[model samples]
Target: MSTITLSSAARARATGRHFVPRLSWLWSGLFGCLVILNIAPLIWGILTSFKGQADLFRFPPAFVSFTPTLENYERVFLSGFGGNLGISLVNALAAVVLALVLGLPAAYAFDRFNFPLRRLLFLAVVASIPLSIGAAALLIPNYVYFASLGLTNTPIVLPMLYAAHQLPMAIWVIKGTIEGIPRELDEAATADGCTTFQILRYVILPLVRPALGAAAILVFVGSWNEFVASSVMVDSPSLRTVQPAIYSFIGFFGREWGPLTASATLAILPILIIFALFGRLMVSGLTKGSVKG
Candidate 1:
């Protein structure tokens, strides 16, 4: 094609882009549907908190409240649900920390070394992805084993479970992040008489801090929301986490909506806030991992 014709075609495409009504409508329609789907449940949950359980069960179901009250929120928050949420938070935090401690070094090794069985082991780890090994199936063995180990029905079990469950993906994430760093950097550091640990501390870790932060959040959030393992492993009252509390709420005598709603709201707020703050870094880490080998 001639340069003039190519330029004219480009200009015409640009002009056409300015008035692409069908494209605009398509995007708007899709966006609207997605927004509604995402927001509706959240809005419904919030609205449900304001209404009494009886109000929620009304024949037609009240979409709009004539007499919204704080009862459900009160029940959720003021009750022991707050304590349960606190337990979940602590469990998540402990799990993420444990994962980082184990995963970072493992990731570094996998990224930097030429050890035997590395690829095989990594593939084995990846293979666990599709396998459903939830606590229900493992319950009998877990009880017997943890009973012998004496870690059963304790808060200590939470971190261990969280880390164990998240260890594979966490290691994968950090290892992938580490692999992106130039190998030349390690050699450069070694030439300067730096030890492997020092190189990791000063070089690799600093460069991959964003990925680490994102991993920490992701690991913690997953653990915090983990219901099955916690429910099966910890039957002690104080050890119970938030999701179990929600389950307990359903069985409680008399309808208490206020505190229940408040607890749910509280449970949601921290994660939402953390994501809102670190969303950019998380996106960047994921993109960086995805685009790399």
Candidate 2:
């Protein structure tokens, strides 16, 4: 009886070991398919951007090899797209900077301080996430106000709108990140006579580096991709952003597909580049507090 029991236990261990590899293979293939599915459209856009307009309507779509041309790129540059690209860059960067300046301290306050209506205010921040009010909804009022003030088509309006739009989300995200950090560290700093701002600038900020990076990326991307707001806020050619500028490829007669796709490819390039460079920071921020102190 003992020998039979030992034999069964050994078999069970072996079976479990064998099952893990099969399960891992199954999950690997499933996630591989998912990754490929997500990346396919982006790959197609890049390929289409390279193809000439004649190849666009070809019977069998060329996935591998096709004659590529730079005419679309040339057209994009010659049509004042460079100026729009610069506007987008400036707007995104400025919005992110403004958001961090305003939102980070608010997040820290929410996380560390006890105040009246704290829960209610935090809830409001969270609730803003589901609010679907778009730029069109506020366009008439903003247009009237800005026009009255003679601020229409100014360089500052779009960035300010982007910062306002992204502020609540930034506060909520950073507050959550701050909550994950141990309060004991704050107490320790207090015991050492560190001022509130010093603790924030020295200890809290360094620990929350990942969250700041994530918020910056989110705000930047949101500002960069915003079209309706940019279109409504600034109609001046000099103040237009990349996304609205892409519409120049369309005309009353016909849409220029090649230049449109090329511009789209260019619009998405900065986002991809930003992630490629700093994605690890976001990952680190998420995992930094995972292990117990």
Candidate 3:
């Protein structure tokens, strides 16, 4: 009986070890499939950007045999896409700076102070996140308001709107990060004769750097990618942003796929470079801010 029991136990252990490896393989295969699904389109777009116009319509699509040309990129730049790219960069950077400037102080206040209606105000901020960013219903009203104020068609309009759109979320992110910090630090700073602003600058800012970085990246991306509002807000060709400029490739007759893809490839470079450099910091900040300490 003892010998039989020992053999059964050994068989169970063997089965468990085999099952674990099979499960790991299954998960890894699924993960690989997801990665391919997300990355394949981006890879294809880059390849298409390099292909000649003739290769674009070729049967079976030339994955590797096509002779690459810079003509498409040249056309894109000569068509004022370069100017649009510059406009987008400036607007996005401006939005990032504005959102961070306004959001950090509000977030700090929300986390540290207990003013009247503070909870209600924070709740409104949270509610505004989805309403302002996700909903298109506000577009017409915002355009009308801007038009009334003569803010439309100005270079600063889009950046201001983008900053406003991102501010609520930025405040939320920074507030979460601040909550994770201990009040003891603020008290210690106060003991060291730090004023409210000084404590926020010297203590909170350093600790919440990750959250700030995340907020900046978010605001930049949002402003950079914004199209509908930008298209409606500005009328001048010189003031047009990257997305609306990309949309110009869709003419009344047909699409300019080559230049479109080329411009798109160029448009994504800044974002990719940002991610490559600060991707870890953004991810760490998000993770830290999400879970309170």
Candidate 4:
């Protein structure tokens, strides 16, 4: 029996040692495939941006053999894409600020307080997340309502709409983070004669910095990439955001692939820079927020 038990344990250990390397290889391969899928288009877009109009339609799609040009970038800038970029930056920043300002307090209220229909309200907020994915469906109604109120084509509308669209998700993210924190901290602050606002400002805010960073990234990205609402809500070129501005490269006749790709390449820079700088904070916040205390 002892000999049999020893042999069985050895076999199990050997099996595990073999299995672990295979499992690791499987996961590594899966991750590599995902990276390719996500990054190939971006690489193609950047390469296309630098290609001349003639090089764009080359046989077999020139990955490296084509002569690159700066004309597309020049055209993009000369066409006032710079202004559109600025407008998008402003709108995205405004939306992030507005969403955070409103979301943080609302999240705290939902997590820390009990009121009439509180559960219902929280459910509604969660439901709204799915509904927001169908923003195209709401375009006509939003346009008509805004047009009636003389808010259409205004500078402020996109920021406000972006904020409203992202607010619920922001609240959800922040609330999840808040839930991970212990109530003992709030109680301790209260015992020290801290008011609700003071407690939140000094204690809760410091701890939930990661979550806030994550929420801001989400809101900023959403607002920056928004196209349908930006297109319908604002008519003036001066009020146009980046996505719609890029869409203008498609005309009734044909598409200008060079400038289109160039604009797209330029448009992604801010987001890339942001992610490069604060990605760690965002990841930390998201991971920490995902669990409850």
Candidate 2 regions exceeding 4 Å error are: 1-18, 130-150, 182-194, 289-293
Deviating ranges (above 4 Å) for candidate 1: 1-21, 129-140, 252-262, 290-293
TM-score list, all predictions: 0.85, 0.86, 0.95, 0.94
lDDT (CA) per prediction? 0.78, 0.85, 0.91, 0.92
lDDT of 1 at 106: 86
Pairs that collide, model 4:
none
User: Roughly what TM-score does model 2 have, to 2 decimal places?
Assistant: 0.86
Model number with the top TM-score: 3
lDDT of 2 by residue, 109-222 (tens): 998999999999988887775322345666788779878988878988888888888888778667767888889998999999999999999988987878888878878888
lDDT of 4 by residue, 1-293 (tens): 99999999999999999999999999999999999999999999999999997899989899999998999999999999999999999999999999999999999999999999999999999988753344788889888988999999898899989998999988998999999999999999999999999999999999888899999998898899898899889989889899999999999999999999999999999999989999998898788867777
RMSD of every candidate to native, in Å, equals 3.9, 2.9, 1.6, 1.8
Model 1: worst 10 consecutive residues (lDDT sum): 128-137
Which candidate's lDDT is highest? 4
Question: Which parts of model 4 have CA positions greater than 4 angstroms off?
Answer: 1-5, 131-134
Error of 4 at 209 (Å): 1.6
Error of 2 at 76 (Å): 0.5
Residue range 1-293, candidate 3, lDDT tens digits: 99999999999999999999999999999999999999999999999999898999999989989999998999999999989999999999999999999999999999899999999999999988863454467889999899999999999899899999889989988888999999999999899999999999999999999999988998888788888798899979989999999889989989988998999999999999999999998888788867676
